[model samples]
Target: SLEVPFPSSREAVIALRSLSPDREPRKGGISKQLTVSGSTLSWSADEARILRVSVNSFLDHLSLVLETMEMFGSPVSQ
Candidate 1:
């Protein structure tokens, strides 16, 4: 399991949505799960290799998200 903290719950939820697949994995015995609680994201995978790949991909995407957030501004509602 991996736990990542975000600045806010909204940011964490955004990260979770961005990282999650549109549909569940088709392969059997290979599962990846992501959940957001408060300002943190928890990730779990059924295999080591899958976990590694997912983490690397998530980090890459997360960096882009953070950079975008920094470039623009927080997605706060009025």
Candidate 2:
């Protein structure tokens, strides 16, 4: 488990995964909705770090793209 991130929701995901590798675990998804400030916020966290890692990766990619655009120019659309 140490091969992954520290004590986090992701660790829980991995724990569940390890317990049921052949099939999906029946645990409820993490997160809840709140209505406040005349608005609604639906925040959630997965037991797996997959979503967090993906978000990080997305930010990294965006940063790289911005840096590249600053250094070079906009990429040509395909």
Indicate which candidate wins on TM-score: 1
Cα deviation at 66, candidate 1, in Å, is: 1.5
Task: Score every model by TM-score.
Answer: 0.77, 0.28
Model 1 ranges with Cα > 4 A deviation: 22-24
lDDT score for residue 24 of model 1: 56
Tens digits of per-residue lDDT for model 1, 1-78 = 888889899988887887676525656754877899999998877677777866776777778977887888888774
What is the TM-score (0 to 1) of candidate 1? 0.77
Candidate 1 residue-wise lDDT at 21: 60
lDDT of 2 by residue, 1-78 (tens): 012222334333433333233332335752321111222222224334544544554446435534554577433444
Pairs that collide in candidate 2 are 10-49, 13-47
How well does candidate 2 score on lDDT at residue 6? 21
Cα miss at 24, model 1 (Å)?
6.6
**Lowest-lDDT window of 10 residues in candidate 2?**
33-42
